[model samples]
Target: MAETLTAASSHGEHAHGEMSFWSKYVFSTDHKVVGLQYMFTGIFMGLIGGFMAYAFRMQLAFPGVEVPGYGLVSPVDYNALVTNHGTIMIFWVAMPVLVAAFGNYLIPLMVGADDMVFPRLNRLSYQVFLLSAIVLICSFFVEGGGFGGAWTAYPPLSAQSQYNLTPLGSSLWLVAVGLEFVAFLIGGINFITTAMNSRAPGMKAYDIPMIVWMIVVASIMFMASVGPLLAGAVMLFMDQNIGTAFFDPDRGGDPILWQHLFWFFGHPEVYVVLLPATGLVADIITVFSRKKLFAYRTVLYTVFATGVLSFTVWAHHQFVAGIDPRMAHVFTVTTLLISIPIAEMMFVYIATLYGGSITLTTPMLWALAFIAEFLIGGVTGVFLGASGADIYFHDTYFVLAHFHYTFFPIAIIGFYAGISFWFPKMFGKMMNETLGKIHFWGTVIPFNLIFIPLFVLGASGQHRRIYDFSHFPNLSAPWQQDLRILATSALLVMLAFQSVFLVNFVWSLWKGRKAGKNPWKSNTLEWTAESPPPHGNWSELPTVYRGPYEYGVPGRDSDYWPQNEPN
Candidate 1:
């Protein structure tokens, strides 16, 4: 199989000869190029989302004050910024960077396939994603600015133009989101098909890398879950423009129906992004700790259980949405039950780290931080999962803080970990350790500083959606305002420090130490490929001879054993 693939790759390359710069980089069907396109585009969208966060956080900390680089933000602008920020971060940034980018680049290489099974389809996926991003950005310039009805786009406000006062923006937002979903659906098909069918000749299910399995599972979960959300988006778009009242109570439409559809996918959407990050962390931890993953099959089973249970817990988000007490209780139970498997996965990671020769490299630090920080998010989530507690905490800054704790780690920290670990293979250069560590501390510390204060403010009865708490005397206590200011100030510090990372990334690209293939001396098949692997990855595709995590084996000259290396 390896030889056959190699012959085909060589023939294709020879026939194509040298591609033009645009064909090679822009319009190429190569999985690697498409993956890089997803990555760079996601990063660019992240910057836009981050700036939106900056603008809104500034408005919250100092109401009625003119912000630098942004003028005085009105109530509508604040809502739009907050809404679009969440939308872009999740759909544009997290999905693209975590799933689309890494999945495209790593699947073929890790599985020893020549390319994605559907190469042209992969290119189409990215092109659609880029188009979705453009539509979303264009929403901001449309008549009344971007949609301000929150990222969830719950009806009456999202449905009725008079209520939200941005008919065009809302429709555009819905269309953009729907288009983004279509893009991922296309990409997900490619991920599942390639990982399942195109693995090296000798690689069995268990022999494939954990990350590849994870991405495949995530793709399946996404394809299964996103259908309802896509259908709901269509309904909402109709409600917005066609005078349809799908979610309008007065028109005999059930608003809660939208909640059911959204959360059905929304909760699972959390795990869709999360599984890949955790899988990435799994590979990273084993490599840095110099140990075989403890209970690899157990971890895989736990992930499957997590995915199955994830579907059952969606209604926990609607605990306070006037759901029946019985249904809320049921969802609460399932929600709490789902935590067990996640906890088991976390313990499995710790067991992998136990009694191993651990190296705290930059990637290792981010991996460790993901566990610690996401643990906080999970713990706080238990409170919101309960029907009783959620009644009080819903829509508070506490909820906001809990959300950031979870998603920031999943989306931001996970990206850093994967990128840091794979930087050598991705760019063929080693990032400066000092600069990496500096950026790590700069990011993680300020992250906590920003959110902890929000937790405190939320506990003090602060509502998340208020434009100005000063107008409400009870919510505007001096201490509460102080905490708000501290949170915003910390956000500023965090955003400013990101410049260090930008500098480090560009500088290391040209001036950093050379990274030959397998700089980490890891055992994955991807490590067997060249640094920044050329077109078609390798002259000869490798045959897998072992599982990915064969570290610290006895009677071996080397502690690590590459999967492609013959015994």
Candidate 2:
């Protein structure tokens, strides 16, 4: 039984239109508006990223054959697309959309802050994010058509500065990433400050919503771990601009040093992006399952464990980079050891489902899909974690299939679930459930049709990052044109299916059925307020007595439970 604190709540900043259009639109500090800005930008970037993925997948599946309605993507353009794809997916879509967007929008409400601790700093963080986006886009029109080096931007290649970075394009890529990291660092600092110091009168550490906890820990990870990469990017820029020998092997600099520095932040960057989504799914599943999270404290511990483990596993990306055998071995142990936290959380998830009467709503459906599909990603992760095994799968399409399974589920499924879970709360309207289901099945079936076989071809040793995969130099494995047909056809179907979601998403705000404050009847401060909560969020500051996952109490009137409903 959770006790909710109800203090007199007030909506501040009732002032009406005190500023000009540019001021409010471009420089305003309101988190909700800022979040919406991030949401639209992230979605736009998703379209760009998805199309790049589709364009590349087409080339891989069918060499020398251009699809109708699309021109041939040149190797340089393909390189740009790949770089942009990785960059957009990581920085623009996953981090901004998942963490920055939701963190800004929901964290304050859940923790009972009227607004961020430093609202102007919050707005400036977003402006920096926008600047980063611009720099990245500008790189495309440069003489060499953007940085040809992979998103990893490894040196010797990136450092040659003559072959690829000769023009200012590669220089711009470094600048863009530098700014983006700064954006998050600022936002991360703001998030931690707001959560720790600005909570409602009585909300304690354990009393805050799981989403808040996820973001807080993720922020901490971002702060502690991001410096190496930030410093590395600076060193990289110097290699191109001033000839600092950080990664220039020709100048007695070690290229592997870049990988070490990059993945150092790069690995934890995964959790920085995914942990918020994981927290969102945890709340959504428990609410829909009509039970408390199986082990609340363990879930928090698991989040911390995963964050710690992430820093140690960075070298898993370097097994094939000629890293020392002893270092690789140490990394392998760290990588495998990270799995225990995930496995522990997994046990908690399935355990929650054991005696629950699940409501298969759109959010819950995505959560189920997340668990089942992520198992593939997670297990394959273990396979990659093993250094001896990874030497074979390292550069192959196997890596492709594995991360797509990982990233897509978190990005698509997590955001989609957040969409489903928060739609009512977001727009005060419920999207058509029928259409959501159609979109779900549309993506689920075709998603598998495309990626599963990629694993086969990958295991048979199909190298990644090539435009003409037929030249992969592995002819012993049966190369079939069928892969082309299946993958292309599946991709098209997936695109079309997502259209239903997009359409439903847009159309529902005005046309979908109206929703009540707590439609799903979940146990969280969020449900204690109105659907599309007012600017102030709560009628009163909500105090918590139990954990966020309390649901389906036997004596409850219906199959659901509300977080703050009186015992």
Candidate 3:
């Protein structure tokens, strides 16, 4: 191991070096530190999003009733909460933690490169993201509280200052989101370049870990898809400030154009967030199953297929938005067709588990739960994807429940699996497994408790985005009221459970048991480096000998074979 470290460091200017605190942490170009920075910031923003959800949930559960910590939420406040919560959770929280953080940290290490192809750009990415986040937070303090035009920031309402109500905050929200896109563009380019050019010797395209491949594919998809929306956002910004009529119907501009642009990016945007998660879950499933991943190439091909199909299906979101009726059929077919590749991937995962020596590790638990939860999400999506069913379900709590099912598994559960699986490698210590399992069950159960009832609410004809339900007798029925309270209580339970995870994460960072290299005995190149890999991951570049998953080989003395081992 020491020889391996020495050999790795002996190449080029890749030796582990010391630095001042500010240089090492504050403005460091080290991908690992930058990754952690992204993760912690994302976690903080997720909490804020959660609080926003809690406030709105309270309003839903007990209409007009003031909560203890926070006062009664006004309709304006509720709208702002809805808009900002969706924005923050998806962009600030999920994207940063899952994509930016993990992509920076893992791509080079798994591919056997010392650092990102553009290290300084990597640092710049985080800095710009931090700036965007700060700007968004500042938006909340502006004259009208915060942007209340919903997360989609749809036009007509979002375009015109008079209709939008929160002009200053909405303008800032556009700026913040646009800046976020720019930061990601920078980071996405880095991911593509590094993955394409930075692999160690013998690491071919097929040999790349599924997670790395997914990240690369997602970056490409994001780059390709985000352009129109970025243009739309800029146009919307113009509409907000300069009286441009880009999306304002009254000014002879078509509001539908913004819908086209936003959903063009929006639908694929879900896949952009999802692919990395699926990849992370893929890696974790194989690691704990102690088996080679079943159908690796097939899975990789599905990722490519999914990325391509994602662009075509974005119109599904515009189904109920008064697009050409004829076009709705085209989109409905595309939407349903997109599910086939995804279903294939899911089947492959289940097949991977068959006959494998599955270890019920905390990461494995999260991965399994992700599969189950995501299945529900996927199945429910069919209702929304079909133009006919969407008419009935549109703007209902069903839509909200469906997305949460999808995103929670991808963003929340998948992130937990990655964190639990990689905590040892990242921090050189083992997280408390007892607490981790507790957190997992605590989260999974309460999460379902919260969202499952929402499906019922949606079916009960309770429309979404309603500030107060007291006036609608059908929606305000006693039973519906009870269900809402149940969901809110479940949310509180989930929050309490999250505290356990927070404590575990911080406590484990400093005091947990030491983790030696390759603690999980996995085959990836990341484990070839030291736990908490040093600056410039390898002292000398290491070569990959085989694919990422080589577990449970027949006739081998050990159940797992590291990718770098001599054949």
Candidate 4:
């Protein structure tokens, strides 16, 4: 430990040659190391979340079917799976992998900084996140098991402690969620401060890569949007632990207040996740397509426009939640309006690919699929955004399909795009392209198979969160059971494919082909550094002379023009 600290105390990037194993990998302050830690942990949590989904999907497909060890999953058990699945996937898996991991790895490297301005705080951010995950995992073992209240944890249900299935679990769940928020809050502050204050010499605002800019904006949006929910979490916690009636309607507290608070943050949280992905896709597609990103400044403006507009559309989620009827029209307009900027981003992606020397690399496949799939997610949302249509669709499998379409592509696929595109940069070795493409096909096909049937089930009036569809005549109609079985089977297939990715990821780090500094031949600042950059990122940070997406300029000797290449 003493030797580790001694090495860390050394100044400058090159002076860390004596770094002990602990100083170099565990408890390390290096941004790249920290990012990989977030990645691995997040992926682990994702598997847990997937298992939860599998449990509930099994129940849905074959009600009362007994397992080898555990007996038939009770309705209560099904509800718990539903609740924890949503909570863990969104909070633990998606946020950590999509935002925290890459954000930490790329912001400094791409922005031409040595590391985050607040490196220790960055370390602390991940620590708190881990602690939160532990607390959540602990909830599952508490008296009565984890809270059965849905991830939304809408109150009266969540507020009643004595009668609730997992009173202790609910309280712990709140604490876990609140801690996760705090962790990200710390990271968000570091992200914004670093981007605003720590740019290398000669790098101006416009010179900053779109990925960094989008992440910073997303961080700010998160910080701003989360305040109401943070306050709401506190109030709900008090209601659950103390004798407060903040969300208990029987005690003069409005249950609806919780919905408002949750969705206000919840809706903007979607954009908070998506914007970074939008920026990543922008960068990845440009690199693979061999073209300068079309309308780069325009895309940046669209990102800002998307963030600013996100706050206004939060009530779209509350359309059928008994809010004032007149407000629906207002929210509907805002919700529909938000799509214009999103559509602009998609159009620009297509334009960039139009006249380019496109290479359908694994990452490029993910990027292109992200655009195509996310568009479906976006278009379907318009139906739910309309107050009238949502009246029927609320809480149906349709909403489930809609969000999975949006989130699956953006969070799951988008993260893979970035991970695959930058695998060499992150670990200094190539991920096997053949396995990557195989994994891609394995994922994309089964993903569609699972969700498309879900839309059918929803359109047929199958409400979500019900434990036994056989009990309901409308839901248990002849083909409905078959549909459930099919979706569940597809889900298992999807889970099976993820194993391929897991093996490829673990095997490639040591055994894959050596990836030199710039395997992709892309023009980004991070690529200018060594693959898996050393302790301080650069012995001396490179100065940026141009924007990140300067490809295919006429008369250039090579197809790419790097940002640090002097004109």
Candidate 5:
């Protein structure tokens, strides 16, 4: 499997310095340590995002009643929760886990680098990300009880925070997110440079693993798109602090500019997270099915195509924001085109499964789920991409369902799938397979319960971000009743469902079965090393003779040929 040692174990890159626990572990620049930092931080953020959603879901399903977990919901607090929920889910939960954790861990090892091109820069990026998380967490206690206008922080509503609720923590909310984006921007730079120039002998640009391809393209996406949001964040800071009027209408600033900037990074940010999962799916799909990825060039081209198209589709989110009718049409056309490449990719996956031996491990289960979940999300997205349908669907719970379907499967479920599949390689042990199956079923049943009804709500015209909806009873139909019950029931089940996963994840750390390296007969470079891999990944650097996906090749010793093997 792995014949080549990474730079960490290479002749010149070894470290022998004595170190204290704090310096060696906490502040270390080792990509593995940094990766741990990202995982823990992302889990922490996930808890926050999860709870925030729980709180708001309570408000929506049982409006006007004091909920058990939350006390009598104040109107301002409800809005604040919604705002924080969106912010936390998008920035903290998805990006940190996807970009920071996986990127830090895999990029160096897979590319045969000892560490990132800028190791110290990697450490500093995580530090800043930590600080950003802290600052955002602290915003909850701000005098007015955090920003209440919603996560997008639209102007008029978000700009005059004092007017609607009180500037409260509204001003600081921008700072928290602004800092977070900076963290990713720095992280992206490190990823791009490391992959470009740092490969072992015989590893060409195309020879790199699919996961690395994902990291490269995603980093490029992050670099190109995040600037506008950052500029918007700075303007928002000025509008709130220096009274710069960038978003203040009275002072001749347009609120819509803030949205334009936001969805700009915002939409591409979805792919920034999705591409990695797609890469993981490609890897997992081929490995478990005992076949190569169906069309390697097609996968690469589609990924490249999607990254470029992600930028142009940002305005689809802005369709209902009172933008020009012509702009909506342009966005509609572009958004639809982006889906073509994705549909092509989806076809590749479905086609690859045609004649392969499919295994159903936890990782495989999650990968299959990723396909199902992402497809649902992708299909729903079509309605929202068209200008006519979007005008009706935008700002409604329908939009909420649409993205959750995509992001949950793509980002949350996608990451979960990767982590579970890689857990053996990551932690050096096999998880409880039976328990894992139970966890998967728990996740699947409740997830569909939670998001599917939101589509029904969208059809009925229930707008998102509404704190109190008792006034809307007059417009209700029988369908809304069924949906409200369904969504509420699903939310409860979903929360309870996480416990199964948590228990399996925690218990497996100490009690699970021991696994040999390459338990899945995977062909990628990572499997050539020891289970849980040493500080330096390989004993010696292995020369590459073929691409990473050499499954079912005739005359091989086994079902797959390792990437580092000689022909």
Candidate 6:
């Protein structure tokens, strides 16, 4: 095995040494580079989304005032900012960072493969994603100033350029979204195929790392649910430009059909991003807490249950959309039932941490925060899930608060956790832990402060879609306006503290301590490879002998056991 690895390493070095910069970084087929591309691009888009949030929140808090960085926030501008903010964060930021980037980077290394089964397809996926982002950005500069019908793009508003007032922007928005889905569809296939076919010899399905399993399941969920949305996007695009009224009720079409199509994928889309974040948390907590994952098979089963139940709950979103009471009752049951499996997964994570040697490292902090914060999201969701409560809460700040509670943990905190955990391996250097903890406290505290006020405002009957609360006498009261100001103020603090993270990330890349392989003393196969693994992940591929989480085996000298290590 050593001899084989030595020869392979020598060959990889020669080949990598001969490649030019463009071929190496730009057009490279290396999964790590492709993953880095996705990560950086996602981060860039996150900034745009954040800025949009700042602009709109400013409009809400201090109506008709010009935002500091962004100029005046007209109603049209407010709509555009809100619509694109949601769209960019979900499609561009969350999917890419949580699924594509980490999946591409971790799968091959953890599974003991040198590269993905179809390398060219992987490269094409990212290229398509980048192009889609560019198209979405360009829509902002077009004649109509971006789509204002909201990210859901409901018809009448989304289908008719007359209602939306963005003939060009709405179509471009649809096109960009369609292109983004295509990219993920391609990437999802690669993730599933590679994990299935490319694992090192003797690595059984049960032996796979939890993060890899979560990514694979997430990809499957995405592929399964995305088909309907893709078809809908095309139809909606045609409706906008080519005179099709697929979603136009006035033109002999059912607008509700678009809702069905959108939410069909939309609710599952929540779990799609969610499962990957859960997976990241699972791996991080287990490693940092120094314990094997509690009830590994059970966790997998619950994930499967969550994915299946995710489909049934989509209709719950339409309860207030004029769906039947009978139908709403059925969906309400399913929505409440879906919580059981997710709750079980949370308990399982807590069980794993119960008696373990807990380390409050940066990554560990983010992982723990994911649980605490997401609990608030899940508990609050029960209200919105019920038909009776939803009628009042729907489109209110309550729903918005519930959404941020869920997604902030899933996307933002998840990204920070995974990146902090994998920074050493990805960049061959250790991050500054002091700066990391500072960023974590700074970010998480403000996050809660921002959303909790929204929750209160929402319960006070403040609607989410309002351009200015001053227009509504009841919502514009002193107390309610104060909540808006508080939430907006918290958002500013959160955004400002992000610079600490930026400095830490950039500085640590070149100037921090050099990290050797297995900095975390992890047992996963990825940790067995070099820090910032080379073109070929390992000179000699690993052969697995055990499951990933094997901490504190009674008779072992070292506390953890690597999957590739043979007795």
Winning candidate number (lDDT): 6
Question: How does each model score on lDDT?
Answer: 0.92, 0.81, 0.91, 0.88, 0.83, 0.93
lDDT of 4 at 77: 79
lDDT of 2 by residue, 1-567 (tens): 255443332334532336777766676677766777787788887888888778876776666668555568777777777887898899889988889988988888777665687788888898899899889888887888778788898887787666564357789989999999999999999999999988765456777778899999999999989899999999999988886898977778888988999999998988887788888888888887777778878888999999888889999899999899999999999999998998888788899888887889988999888888888888988889999999999988788899888888888888888878888887789999999999999998898888887787688777776677556455323454566558777988998799999889988987988888877776677667777776556656665555566576667677554435445
How high is each candidate's TM-score? 0.98, 0.94, 0.97, 0.96, 0.96, 0.98
Off by over 4 Å in 1: 1-4, 7-15
Per-prediction CA RMSD (Å): 1.3, 3.0, 2.2, 3.5, 2.3, 1.9
> Please, what are the lDDT tens digits per residue for candidate 4 over residues 278-346?
889989999998998999888889999998899888777787778898888999999999999999989
* Pairs of residues at least 3 apart in sequence or in different chains that clash in candidate 6: none
Q: Residue by residue across 1-567, what tens digits does model 1's lDDT show?
A: 223667245426422568899989999998988999999999999999999999999988899999899899999899899999999999999999999999999999999887888888899999999999999999999999999999988887888888787879999999999999999999999999999888887999999788888889899999999999999999998888788888999989989999999999999999999999999999999999999999999999999999899999999888777989899889999999998999899999999999999999999999999999999999999999988998999999999999999999999999999999998998999998888999999999999999999888888778988999999999988998888889888889999888888888999999989999999999988888889988788878888899999999999989999999998
Answer with 2 or 6, whichever has the higher TM-score.
Answer: 6
Give the TM-score comparing model 2 with the true structure, all chains together.
0.94
Model 3: how far residue 307 lies from native, Å: 0.5
Evaluated at residue 192, the lDDT of candidate 3 is 96
Per-residue error for 151 in candidate 4, Å, reads 0.7
Off by over 4 Å in 3: 1-17
Evaluated at residue 231, the lDDT of candidate 3 is: 92
lDDT of 5: 0.83
Off by over 4 Å in 2: 1-26, 67-69, 472-481, 556-567
Residue 400, candidate 1: how far off, in angstroms? 0.7
Global lDDT of model 3: 0.91
The list of candidate 4 runs beyond 4 A from truth reads: 1-17, 68-71
- Between prediction 1 and prediction 4, the one with superior TM-score is 1
